[model samples]
Target: MITFAPGPSKVFDQVGQYLQDAFQTGILSANHRSAAFMNLYQETETLFKEKLHVPEDYKLLFTSSATENWEIIAQSIVESSSFHIYSGSFGKKWYTFAQHLNEATGSHKLGTEDALDVAGLEIDGKHDLIAITQNETSNATEVSQELLGALGEKYPDKMIAVDTTSSMGGIALDFSLADIWFASVQKCFGLPAGLGVLILSPKAIAKCESKGESGRYNSLSFMLENAKIYQTHYTPNVLGVYLLKRSMEDHPEIQVTDALVRKRMKELETVIAQSKKLTMLVQNSETRSKTVMGIAGEELFIKEFKKAAEQAGMQMGSGYGPLKPTSFRIANFPAITEQEFENLLKFLKEY
Candidate 1:
């Protein structure tokens, strides 16, 4: 069946084989501290740096998933306050996690969530840090480059973090503007779940080292220290790492200037326009994510579309938040071919 769900969507043929081969070679059975495992781990980090155009000063750390990274950031980096910029559920969730962490650690009253009225809102440079989700998978919303740059200018003293979970590999990321940028490989990377890629700036590292009194495991300082030598403090999803490494190796090019990405987006726009029963969810094109498109239509249309599509061999994503009743999502990642898209459109038309 075709999977148009946001993540754990698809994997390259080679990535699948790599997992099978790894199991056969007993690489999955070897100790995590062994030289062989360390070499593989280091190579994966190197590949990430090359593919993500991650700055030399920034460090990369792999975790279980983006959910775990949220706790890591909340526990290690957020001590006093964080001005969270929220446009969707993921961003709101991160802010909630920080609030809970603050209450648990008693780390000086944490900050409140700022309403994401992009035009009227201004970044208060007073907070300890600024957090924004680069791409919102749930709503197919994105914080624009202009917004990030403006915030950086106003909040030079505060560190900035981004959740790029759905945008990495599918878009060009400017890590220079944000202190921490992270993603999960399952979405745009065309791999399975269980691996989250996190990159940290020097300033973020300093904050972690200073505020990491929250304890171990979720400590960014510990992750950073071990990452220096290419390792994780705890046992990692070794097979997921192998698939990530193989996927990166398979597509070494970092810059995602694919004409096809643009072409498919345009095609989707045309399709969206023609369907009277359906409409693109996000109001702003500037903030719409290229990787995932949120579609809102008649509830009957969605229910019928979902049921018919599944019978005809398609798997569309359920809505993430309050929109679950009226909205669905479409993934336009690299692995989805033009023919497949045409088929999807045809199915939609028929249904």
Candidate 2:
């Protein structure tokens, strides 16, 4: 089945052949620190930086998943105090994690409130970090870059960490404004699960250093120090890393630019606009994610839509959380073909 599920949706065609060759070539079982492995690792990191347009000084760190990055950020950056902004289900999870941390370590969380209606946040220097989920995958909401810039500028002293899990590769992100940015490869990188890419500015690295020995595993400093030697603290998902490397290489910037993605998004906008029953979940176009588009239909229509798509050998995403059964999320990441988009539209029209 062609998976349109939010994550683990589909792998690149070339990536599959690459993975098969990987095992046959013995690169799958190669030592993490081997010369051949490091070459691939470094090349992957360099390609990511090039494609993502990350600043030269920023460093890319790999982990098991975005969830693991949550733990790493929670343990290392939250310190004794923080201010968390929550807009939707995923944001609420981060806030809940913070509350749990508060109870466990007696740490303080200040100005914790739902980010959906957050108009004005008063920032004091007391809070060590300010957490924001760049894109709310659950609710199909994204905080705009202008708002993020305002928050960062308004609170120069507050360290910022953002979760760009669902929208990273499909959208244009300004990594300079955020102290730390992380994403899961499954959603936008067109790869399988079990790998998360994290980019940290020098400021974020310095904050981790200030923590002073954050118990080995979840420490950003530890990852940074070890990554220099082309290694991970634990046995990294070497296969996933290699696949990610291959995917990055396969989709170069010269051929697939953000402008191309934006153009496709515009085309999708026209398609969505023409559909009477299939409206968008996000009211504001400015905040809509280019990669994932949530469609609003009745419960019966959603079921019909899914059934029809599956019968046609296509998979579509279900609305998450509060919108489940009322909507379907359509992922139009770069890896998806034009024919697939047409097929989805055809199915929508029939239902």
Candidate 3:
């Protein structure tokens, strides 16, 4: 069945072939430190640059998931405290998780529909790292580029980390704006759930060295040392990297894909606007996420609608967190073809 679930959401149409190629090429059995694996890892990093427009100065590394990176950031990067700016569930979850590791973690909350006013929000001097979720998957909201820019401009000396879990590959990211950027491949890369990409600017790398904490298995310093030789700090997700490389090899560059995703987002807005039964969970049009769209309706209607969509051979994303009962999400990743979106829209139009 066609899937529009936000994550573990849609596999690329070529994934079956990719899996076969992996087996045929012995990618599953290759040693993480072997010459072959090193070659594979290096090639994947190269593809990330060519396809995603990641900056050359930024260092690339892999992790089990985005959640793991949170711990990595806490252990290796934050010495004093990390201040968080967020609105929805996932962002709050990150801030909460940071608190367990660092006692002085700070948070600034905003309303779900509120626009980001960066100049007005005061950040404490003690918080060394500033963290924000680039996309709020739970509510289908995104942090504005202008706000990110404002933060970078105002705090040029501070470290900035962004969780771009849902929007990384689907949009054109401004890598220069943040010191640390991370995302799981499931949402936008059309890969499975096991792999997450972490990128660190030279400034971020300097923080890891200055903090000088390398005890954790996922420490930034350890990950960096191995990455220099095109290796991972631990037993790697060999198959996942193989699949990601193949996916990136065939994918269009970010600018082309970004245009398409944004165009389709507008189409979805039009469809939702015409629908008597649906309203967007994110009311601010500018803040609506380009990769994931959350649409709301009556509780029973949402249940029936999802059931009907499933019967029509489409698997819709369930509502997340507090919005679960009244809303459902749609994944607008690159794997979802225009024709597939049209098919889903046809059903949305009819229902």
Candidate 4:
């Protein structure tokens, strides 16, 4: 079946060949400390910097998942307090996780209707770190890049950490706007859910150095020290890193993928606008997420729609969190072909 599940969704068509090649070449069992593994790590890091436009000065590290980055940040980066700003369930969960680690952690929940407004946001002076969810996967709302730029300017002293899990490879982000940017490979990277990619600015590294809290085995300092020599603090998913490198090589240039995603998102928007039975869950078009589209309708209609799509050989994502019964989600990732998207749109029209 053609899967539309948000994460662990669709992998690149070349994944089978890459995996086969890895098995035949013994890449799956290569020692993490071997020269071969170091080369592989450097190659992947180069691809991220050149193709994905990660800043040259920033350091890239890998983790088990993006969730782990939260703990790393709370323990190593936030010295005094952190202010979490969220618009959806995932963002709220991250905030709660930070609060558990630091008692001084606080949060600001933006109103759902005008969630993208960050111009008038007031952050406490005591909070040294500002956490922003770049893309709210649970609700399909995105914080604008322009808004992030504004925040960086307004609070230059406060370190900014952005969670770009669902939007990372699908969009071109301005790396200078935030101090720390992280994402999991499962969504836009077109890979399985095993590895997380983190890009940290020099400011973030300095914060970790000054704080010097070695909270976990995968602490920022340990990861940074190992990453300097193109290695990890512990054994990592070698297969996941290989797949990510292959996927990046397949694209070569991020603009090609970004343009395609924007084009397809527009097409999908047009189709959704023309449909009588479907409406967008995000009322404001400006704040709507291009990577994940959430559609809302009558409860029975949504149920029947998912059933129809499934019967037609499409496995779409169920709405996340509380919107499950009245809405459904569509992943607009690179692995999905133009023909597949057109076929899904045609099916939606017929339904």
Per-residue lDDT value at 98 in model 4:
93
> Which portions of model 2 miss their true places by more than 4 Å?
103-119
For each candidate, what is the lDDT?
A: 0.77, 0.76, 0.91, 0.89
Q: Which stretches of candidate 1 lie over 4 Å from their true place?
A: 103-120, 123-126, 212-214, 349-351
Q: Provide the RMSD of all predictions against the true structure, rounded to 1 decimal.
A: 3.6, 3.2, 0.9, 1.0
Write candidate 3's Cα lDDT for 1-351 as tens digits.
Answer: 899999988988899999999999887999998999999888988888888888988888989998888999989999899999888998999999999888799999878778778779888899999999989988899988878999999988789999999999999998989999999999999988999989999999999999899777787888899899998989999998999899988988999999999999999989999999999888887778889999999999999999999999999899987789899999999999878999999999999
**Per-candidate total of colliding backbone pairs:** 0, 1, 0, 0
Candidate 3 TM-score to native = 0.98
Cα TM-score per model: 0.90, 0.91, 0.98, 0.98
Worst ten-residue run, lDDT, model 1?
105-114
Give the alpha carbon lDDT tens digit for every residue of 1-351 in model 1. Answer: 888988778655577688788889888987777887788888887776787777877887889888888888776887766767767787878877887766432111112122244455555434577778877888887777777877777677878888989888887777888898888988888887888988888898888888755457767777777777777888988888887787788774656534566678878877887887988887567777778888898888789888888898889998887889899998878767667788987876655
Mind giving the per-residue lDDT tens digits that candidate 2 earns over 1-351? 677677767766677797897898898888877887777778877887788788888888889888788778878776766677656677777777776766532221222122333346665566778888777777667777888888888888878889889878877788899898999888778888888988899888888888865565768777888778777777778898888877777776623656766777677778778887778887677667667777887899788878878888988888887789898787767667667766666666665
TM-score-based ranking? 3, 4, 2, 1
Evaluate residue 249 in candidate 4 and report its C-alpha lDDT on the 0 to 100 scale.
Answer: 87
Model 3 weakest lDDT span, ten residues long: 110-119
lDDT of 2: 0.76
